[model samples]
Target: MFKIVKKWREQGTIERARGTGLENKKTTNNEDATLIQHLRAHPFTTATAAAQITNFPASRRTAQRRIRQISDFRCRVAAIKPFLTQQNKENRMGYAMQYLIFDQNFWENVIFTDEKVFQSSRNGKIRDFVLDSMKHILNKTIAVVDFPLMCGPGLVVGVPDCVGELMVD
Candidate 1:
């Protein structure tokens, strides 16, 4: 408290002075910028991987600290999102236009169902530094449903043994 009052009386402001703390001994400004650039290009790169790939002379802990110092990046769990191509978009538009004339009564007879595959044994606690949460990362794999198969009459769902390979029952 006495030191705080003394500094306040001396500087006429309570705000701390810039560049008063200890300097970084492991990495320099240019190296930090290079690390940041590498992370921006490949957000999934782990701290150790980034250090190795960027040829950072410091340890993995220093590299991690550098990443944490940057305000624009954040480590978060990736979200699942379906990726659509141009051909897929066109097909969807055509389907929508074809069904545009259908009335509410006609639509009432239709049933929509969605299926998602969950890996019970897989650990999904992976975290990556990303600039935007809206953009999908490569960590989460997305399998697109081409067309629904008809089994009996009630509802048919397609099961995938592997990605892009669907089996119907």
Candidate 2:
């Protein structure tokens, strides 16, 4: 597919201005060009986890060739992934997409919300926390938790100390 597009480009089928980084090139489509431009603007280390998430189809041999020839695809995927993640978090889209499709009768009038607090250590050298199954297993179990508190209109709200609050059995 890309080869065909490249031939078309070389044969003057598509015309576009080459950016400073792109030099002169041909692409499979406008989408491919967009993807590549995004990549060049945002380069990624070959080891980045988002690469796995994006599921780029080419193999190592193809990567070496393509990285040399089609640098933009690599750049676009890397740049856009982090931006996508940041935007999703800002919009609360990607965090927890849990759909609880349950029996209506049981779920009626049930509202669910949660809160959590954590204690941290000082050795927080800034690095991206790479997530994998093993990491999920290691630190995710919680023995203590809390839910949102509600007070009636004109009622005083105050924090209770170590005893927490009334435990709803």
Residue 25 error for model 1, in Å? 3.2
By lDDT, the best candidate is 1
Best TM-score among the predictions, by candidate number: 1
Query: Which lDDT tens digits does candidate 2 get at residues 14-69?
Result: 54455745664333445334434433333332323223333445444444344445
TM-score for candidate 2, please give it: 0.20
Q: Model 1, 51: alpha-carbon shift in Å?
A: 1.2
The per-candidate count of clashes, in order, stands at 0, 6
lDDT of 1 at 84: 64
What would the TM-scores of all predictions be?
A: 0.44, 0.20
- Candidate 1 — which residues are off by over 4 angstroms? 1-21, 80-125, 132-143, 146-169
lDDT of each: 0.61, 0.34
Model 2: residue 52 alpha-carbon error in angstroms: 2.9
Per-residue lDDT of candidate 1, residues 11-129 (tens digit): 88877676666554677888888889987766655667778888898998888888888646776765665676889756755654565587988656454443445543133445566
